[model samples]
Target: MKKILAVLAVGMISSMAHAATVGSQSYKDNIEVGGSMWIPFGPHADSAGLPGVGVKGVALGQLSKISMRSVRKLTEQNPDYGATDGNNVTVVTPPAHGKVAMGNFNFAQLADSNAEVYYGEWTAHNDTAGATRSVYYVGKDKTANMPTSGTATYAVKGINQYSGNNQLNGTFTADFGKNTLKGSLANNALNVGVDAKINTAAASFNGSATAAGKTGTSQGHFFGNNAGSLAGFAKFDDRKLDTAFGGVKK
Candidate 1:
């Protein structure tokens, strides 16, 4: 019993040491192919590995705090680095357009990795047409000290590749007791519903999504000090668009 307690105490200390907090925004990018969106940055964003080929380097930025507001007359930008991925609750920040918006998404990745993963939605005001909408993050996965029971609700944001890379926002609920997640995203245009089962041991999840008569598969991982955030990708059956989303514990 003493040995077991010692091991458990060590594990707890390690997790608290790597707890999530505000850190530098290292890099952010997204991709569109044949009208579908995909993440171009991640823990291996700078690796020579295939599939995404990784990025040369990350564009650093500082996170700010603001409030939630709807973006007006915005178009999706193919590639821009002038936005912050902010959750629509708690902390908020104003975008380049001078509009107030929620913006607090900083978390720690798994200790074995040097990458960070941030998830939230943002609009870039660097475009002439107006601005571009996107979902982004800057860390990897860290799911230590996660709650073993109870439920957590999150405010989610993402990019819809089919809708010209438009912004998608909604809420997601994670049930730690049942190890499940359910979420929905919609605007004045369309709605998307997602469901997934959580693997508590792996700190990951996979499931299905439905939207406008189309079905898709969704997969993502949990992050933060106590599994306070999540981010993932969804690919539809029609191959029309891809959705990437993330959120913070609300």
Candidate 2:
């Protein structure tokens, strides 16, 4: 009787494992797409205490929205083990007729189990003041992970106002399972023809982040000749997870 009982226990365990696998697959199959939206506050306030003039606070005078989306496919091994083959990112700011709008398109390929390579292009249009302007950017990002941690390198070029600026490069590295991301950008040249050497600079940010449930902060510095000497600090808190779903109507 003891031997028969052991055999029955083994069968029950196998049945439970199969049930769990099926449930997990179903969850992955139903996950269509997801993204996030961040609303900036006091850090964006103007020195005059008037809001929205600078990057310190939200510009209620204007409407801006940013979003990201991914198209992922499930793998046979594990429904979640599949890949994200494409992504679309968009930023829209209103006062539509005279405002600026931007969009970025990204295509990604899973080169291996833990590595992905992506190519993206960005375009921005502004019809503000008496000036009508546009800019275009193209870039690539390569990310990889192995025995230890992971790293990514991104490089992009911008063409604006009929002038060419060759470089905006960034590098990021992270330890396995850590919420912290350490990264830096260098030799960034902005506003090429107008400022020439004025916007040439180097900047770095090293911060720890606790996501969704924990508060976190990071501080960094930037130095450049064109922007005429500026420095500041940044922080994050009250992080939470939220969801939204919508689709275009026929």
Candidate 3:
């Protein structure tokens, strides 16, 4: 019993090290494939990573604090969905959009023979009025982490945009497997090399893939923690965008 408690304590500490996210956003429809309309959490324009952080980190705490508002179920003829549960529900994982998972995803590939991996998901968030949406810290749990080292090729959808202040919202498209991302791994971090070939201007941010304001020639650095997830910041060319991302392994 004592040993079990000790292990649980260690796990909790490790989870804290990897940016913390404590809230759930459920979805009656999957936001990855554009099945349902987007939902708003916390503020209309929130960051992407941890609360009060420089990067466009998600304000999970703030999101959890927002007052619930009633939403009309489009599927139903005329039923008030009542008020939402704020950010305190099991999240619905986003679907895969082309090569990229519409939801926020993170991986940690160890420098070993077999790649050990874990991941999680959160339903995408959106604000129609602001035309903004997001998905970060999917699963929002830290126990599930993956390992990715060396040259690792995966898919990532669209791009993130961060104003001088904070992130607008999490966003992606419905073209499953449309974009692929490549990253090089170190002992504790993965350096996602920017593909200059990708037309940043053509790529999307919080909504349309063809949207503008896309920059070029940039990289993302994701650091791992004992909790089995990764959180990192990103910057684009011409300083057009900056973002902090967190996700679980697949």
RMSD of each: 14.3, 21.1, 16.4
Candidate 3, superposed: residue stretches over 4 Å from native: 1-14, 17-60, 63-126, 131-150, 157-193, 196-213, 216-250
Quantify all predictions' global Cα lDDT against the true fold: 0.47, 0.21, 0.25
Tens-place lDDT digits, model 1, residues 1-250: 7975564344334323433321211123421101011212332112111111111121221211111111110111211212322322212223555332222121112222222443433333233231233333334335767688999998877655323345677999999999899989876666878899998877777899887878877777777668877777565644334456667778
Query: Which regions of candidate 1 are displaced past 4 Å?
Result: 1-115, 119-138, 162-165
Better of 2 and 3 by lDDT: 3
Ranking by TM-score: 1, 3, 2
Q: Give me the candidate number with maximum TM-score.
A: 1
What total of clashing residue pairs does each candidate reach?
Answer: 15, 5, 30
TM-score of each: 0.50, 0.22, 0.24
Report the lDDT tens digits of candidate 3 across residue range 1-250: 7975564344334434434233221111332111111122312222222221111232222222211111111112222311212221222222243211222221111221221221112222332232223222222222223232222233332223322222122321122133333232111112223332222222211211111345323322222332223333244332223333433333
lDDT minimum window of 10 residues, candidate 2 = 241-250
Residue 148, candidate 3: Cα error in Å is 12
Specify the highest-lDDT model's number. 1
Model 3: weakest 10-residue lDDT segment is 66-75
